[model samples]
Target: MSLAQRWREARPPVAGVHLDSGACSRQSLAAIDAAVQHARHEGEVGAYVAAEAAAPALDAGRAAVGALTGLAGSDVVFTTGANHALDLLLTAWPGERTIACLPGEFGPNLAIMAGNGFAVRPLPVDDAGRLDVEGAARSLAADRPALVHLTPLASHRGLVQPLAAMSEVCADLDLPLVVDAAQALGHMDCATAPAAIFGASRKWIAGPRGVGFLAVRPDLAQRLQPRLPPPQWPTALSVLQRLEHGEANIAARLGFSVALGEHLAAGPALVRERLAEVGRMTRTAVADLPGWRVVEPVDEPSAITTLVPTGGADPETVRKRLIADHGIVTTYAGVERAPFEMTSPVLRVTPHVDATDEDVARFVDALAAVSA
Candidate 1:
């Protein structure tokens, strides 16, 4: 079967054309079943026993995450979600109270850095809001921030950052690079070995919510001293596991593992290629809409496409009407999503690999009808 066919068959029936995979993807049957089965097993044989029984699947999932990010299973740490993962990393950051990041970094991440007592500086970027590698390298060398953070794919725009180039720069400068791959893990290639990488299971991975992971370099892991919550354990775990809390939803981790397996079996390269094609198709199809302009280029590498509404059309109202009147789902990104760079609100359309030409047509027609 084609990849789309397999994906469609694996997922439950959708209420409408789902174009908001950037927020939360539709979960597959395998993932849902794994989570539900684990919950049931917990009821049958106590939660701790069930978790012990689930160790192998969980370990396999960790190893898969490590492989994706160019780390080992032992180096992967689980958390509530990407927010928690970042909190763990920033709390354990073994550096000074300053960091540099892209201007288009996610707004919540900025809040997290501030909450952790780190002063933020914007890295140099081109006019298009992408990392200017040479400029960024020069700025990093001159300023010498304690660390560098990158969001490879911004939530409000489709621009893909030059993570590999930045990684090389950090390696040369011996500056630690922390990556927020919440939107990049399944949608794009994430094997770049930075100092630390973190992401969630709910977005492109199509895994259950409430699961996130952090993979740290071995030497960096040793240096990070995560401020563990009250009631710490006496025995020792792996250095990475120290970041994870003792209590967790084991069932969700199993579901995440199943989703990771499903993504791997479908092949990451194939998935990324199909998503890029869908993105290009969506951008082309929506290019001529009245009073709305595509934010990204016709062939942006990522799957996300943002539209800036013109002529006094409120994107938030349009987003609501798309769901209420047309039964189409999408995201309305306000300046709050990327406060530093976004000048206006935008409509975000992010379809998954299972999206069809008909789906794109439906969205275009629905948008036209609602905006008029």
Candidate 2:
């Protein structure tokens, strides 16, 4: 049996063909059970004491994330999720308010920047929703903005941005790059840290919700003046400590550690390989669906495949029918949610590591029926 096949055996059983991995993955039973067990322990020992015992697991999780992102344990700080992590960074950041990001940047991220009083400038992208590297480079040469934020992969689309190429441009101009790898964290290679990298555990990590981390290049982290609620507890000795508030979620961290352990066991390279294969397979399977435009490029690499309906197929209605009638799951991406380059709604279809060729075929059949 394949690695993903074996991994599937250990996870909680799914109600149906689950293809919304881009939102949250069906977690492993061990991951869930570890959380439950930790909660029980907390009840017996009290939250503070239980947290002390969980320190090792917390450290393990940090190490796992660090290894995955090519950072040291000290460089990582846990947060509630990606949005909160971004808020933390923005709160601490004293850089110039003007920032440059791709046209297809995640809507929530854009909101965070705006709420924090940053002037967001949109960079150009190609037809496939990828960052135009040369264009962006040219713009950077002209503006030399205080920060350049990039989402390595789009939440609503299947395209992977040219992160490395953009990084090189930023590096040359001494421009600070902040990458939101919420979609790419566990599924992509993030070892080479730029200024900061932040993501959630729920998506590709297959970890529990309510948990995520922000990894900073240690040297760069020193520049941050982390925020603390008024009457701040003064024990925070480091950047992560200052950002993290009292009473860590011991159970969630334990669960996240188990999930991280599962990822480590499977090996990052192998997991990414399997995910990319399933991505291409699903894209090919639904390529022939009529009256639909494949928004994601055929050659662009990502586990997400978004299909935009045309000729009377309402994207929202299709999404409802996909789940209600077929027991298949998908996320409907409205233009408002994407807001930058998307003009029409799209359906995000994500195939997982264990998803087989048969799974994609069945999903496509049901999708076709719904669209018709």
Candidate 3:
């Protein structure tokens, strides 16, 4: 089937939810269809064929991600998803490598770093979700970390971190910086420094799921021997050898490549401008709600806007209400705080290029009804 036909068939029938590419226009669908055709002709039919032809798609996808981050194609590595890319990075750099990350980072990334046996350190952030740059610098210098993982924007709260300045710090310290751009890829301009950059196409890029890219500086890439050694080694090491192979998601890769082309054609500035407008409208409509708080900064980095209810209101309650009653879908950040500690639950509302003013207004109305 054509990509357009697939998209039309896959698109959920809903009005107010700000999830799933926010607003998929005709241009986007056409681009995806073209990519689908390209993938078919390229012999990307099944897993075995995909594995054999992985390098080309990997190369192409890397170039696209590099353009987004202002890096060279040689610096990029295509991965199955952001999580898998991160796992590869962490596994390759395991053992007492002091790693510093933002406290309010995306939960899964944090868990992966911890699970991989790195000594994880948290950088302090203000209530506004802005990282203390000086504090981060101090922590990095003191710890002399091998890797510094940061999210340009907090996914849960939609606050923009000072990436340019942070990149400068990493450069000065000669530390490798890995940015989780999963949520910021199309919405913001990422630092082009020789740091390792990771992002997924599923979020803002409006691509199929299970496709992401990782960019490691040429120098760093050379140093990274895969966590698993080569196959055909001794029997004792065969299980470990499998880790060396990088798996590619062929269909999703093609979809992501197509989505990226569409995004580039539209231009990042235009996408950001449209999303910002939707965000502003959403904020304005919900600003007067008595107990609801906008967690995103007044001038946040990207198109994601998060809201939280005061007085310990349950986030799931609001999320379920929005999905069930109004057909609006939103996300909540899960917490893992100690007992007796008060953790703020958050509801995320991400605006996509396809989203319209009507969609934003409907979401606002839904929030008002649920909060009331």
Supply candidate 1's per-residue lDDT for 359: 93
User: After superposition, which runs of candidate 1 have C-alpha atoms over 4 Å from their true positions?
Assistant: 229-235
Using all chains and alpha carbons, the TM-scores for the candidates as numbered come to 0.97, 0.96, 0.83
Estimate, for each residue in 113-193, the C-alpha lDDT of model 3 and write its tens digit: 778877777777766657888888887788687788888865566667888888888888998889988877877778456
lDDT of 2 by residue, 29-67 (tens): 999999999899889988888888888889999888888
Candidate 2 lDDT: 0.84
Model 1, 1-372: lDDT tens per residue?
998899999999988899999999999998999999999999999999999999999999999898788788888978889988898888887679899999888999999999999999999988899899999889999999988999999899998888888989999999999999999999888898888999999999999889989888997888877666432756566566668858999999999999999899999999999989989999999999998999899999888999998867899999999999878899999998999888999999999999999999999998888887
Candidate no. 2 TM-score: 0.96
On a 0 to 1 TM-score scale, where does candidate 1 land against the true structure? 0.97
Worst 10-residue lDDT window for candidate 3 reads 19-28
Which regions in candidate 3 have their CA more than 4 angstroms from the true location? Answer: 1-16, 19-27, 31-58, 231-247, 311-313, 336-342
lDDT of 3 at 109: 80
Off by more than 4 A, model 2: 229-236
Candidate 1 overall Cα lDDT vs. reference?
0.90
lDDT for residue 290 in candidate 3, whole number 0-100: 70
